[model samples]
Target: MKKFFYILLVFTVLSSCSEYQKVLKSEDIATKFKMGEELYNEGKFAKANRLFAQIVPNYRGKPQAEKLMYLYSNSFYEMGDYYVAGYQFERFASSYPNSEKQEEASFLSAKSYSMLSPAYTKDQKQTVEAIEKLQTFINVFPESKYVADANTLVQELDFKLENKAYSIAKQYNLISDYEASIKSFNNFIFDFPGSSLREKALFYRLDSAYKLAMNSVERKKEARLNQAKEFYESFKKAYVNSEFISQADDMAVELNGALENYSTKS
Candidate 1:
């Protein structure tokens, strides 16, 4: 009789639990959403997220689903898992193109990516992605509240990318890879005309060209000395007040002498 009573109690609890779940599901969908909001307000972000997730699939095609998805995205944002949260917010905005929350959703999505962006010298994929996504945000929502901040982020991230490239090009100069060095430095100048390092890049290119021309001799078919003179003259016109002017002039004199001597001997 004791074992029989125990079995009956277990069966009754199981049936009650199943019935409770069904009752919760049967409640007006708006009620479930309210419960979720209440949980979120009470700082039960996890529970609210689960509740919001629960309603979306069952309430699909209903007005509640659209609202629930927006709240669902905010739950993750509130939880501070920005990587996932950003993606979720973007998903909500993309999935519900006609919703009133569209602008808010896009802003939050871009903001979330900006939050996850790492420092410039570290992994920059997130930084790059943030720039691109935020540009899209700006293009889509010209009047968004996040525009000012996103604009700042785009500028900062672009500087970050440019700095990396500029540093690499300068490195070529450090190693005396003169041919490659001049090319890279010229690329930097052309690609980033407004770069703060523009003058420095131009100077390095002149230095590289001078050295390359110094390697020129009577035996080589290539008139590298002439090429070097061209680079020096180009740099001088761009940077007249440059500290390198006097030294560059000296190289030109030396290059002329070397070529003259080589020609006379040949």
Candidate 2:
């Protein structure tokens, strides 16, 4: 029984060594790259990236150069490595500007940046760059098949950038920098009129005006209060059921009560 066990162990070791040596041998790269495409089509992105990376540098300036770069870029995209993928895609676009894949490459490069975009509360360099690149794609390939999707992504990222600016402007109000707060909010509203943040921007606008009105609450600041009223009314007209409606209404009542008391004293 011990001798039989020894024989089984020897066979297992030999089998393992043989398989490892086989893996060490260089594969038929074209066949492997094709297999990678198959796996990529199957959503096996990791394996596809490995195969693609293996081929591109070695196949430089070959017919497969452009194709491998494109496939490699796509692999990064499929694996959700947006930043690297974005760069890879951009490289492909620039390298093969007249290639058949130009439209798709340009669009995908911008798409990669869009995917890398952080939330509304984060840095927006990627968001801004994405917009520029996407618009370039739109301009260059107005009739491309990817136009609609590219436009949609650009719109979405622009909204995020608008929201980020809007929120930062509100922060100034929260900390009582009324002048800067108003400026920030106004900039957000004016620059991105097509933003889906329309109602939200208007709401924050009213809030800024309200905060400005409170700058001198006890010193008969009727002018500021009147400005607040205008903004509040605008907010009400646009977003009647706004969550801030009650607070706005309360401000209105308080201002009216103050005016009435002043009249009584006079």
Candidate 3:
């Protein structure tokens, strides 16, 4: 009985494949459309996409074009071809400005770009682009049900940019390029004032300043030490109980001691 059931299943699968091939090659546009939509509804997006691609141009000016375009664009989205999905959805929105699906299409288009964002450690051009797209969606659809999700994606992408900037600044410090590290951190503080990484930035900036001051030549030592002392004061004022407070305190002691030596020489 099980063997008969298995044979029947195999036969049904082969019959379906044969029919699908026939429909795919049949020059019947209506048949293609009907089969494409059925396949799409069944979550067979890849197969649906092939049929839609063949008939898309033929249905351009027809009343069914809008529905067909939506399905076609979403098929790419479902298949994770985000680049094409983004472009196609954008086109769909532009073409069907009055579509009931306009808001959804716009949101999905922006989301598709967001999906293309690379890791924070990589080049951030796509991340920037995604942020712009998401922001536009939020601004245009302030009352949309998708606004909350769009805002979340924007925040995530924003953090990616911030993290990338913070990492570059920290990398400069790691390479002992204290001047560049200080400059980068200063820029980061100015650019992302509300960043969660602000605390780390402040601590590292102080660390960089301390190292730079302590390593200066005799002629510049006193002035650099004074500047480093000021950085310590700034960091401590902001974070009295910071994780780096102990190291910061040790640096402050060295800075103050160095300054006292300068004062005694006067």
- lDDT of all predictions: 0.80, 0.80, 0.96
Stretches off by above 4 angstroms in model 3 are none
Sequence-dependent TM-score of model 1: 0.68
Highest lDDT against the true fold, candidate: 3
Model 1 Cα lDDT, one tens digit per residue, 189-230 = 888888877777777787887787776454552477777777
Q: How far off is residue 52 in model 1, in Å?
A: 4.4
The per-residue C-alpha lDDT of model 2 at residue 188 equals 85
Question: Which digits, one per residue and each the tens of the lDDT, describe model 3 over residues 41-147?
Answer: 99999999999999999999999999999999999999999999999999999999999999999999999999999999999999999999999999999999999
TM-scores for all candidates: the values are: 0.68, 0.75, 0.98
Clashing pairs in 2: none
Candidate 2 on 203-255: residue-level lDDT in tens? 77777777676666666567767777777787788778878788778877776
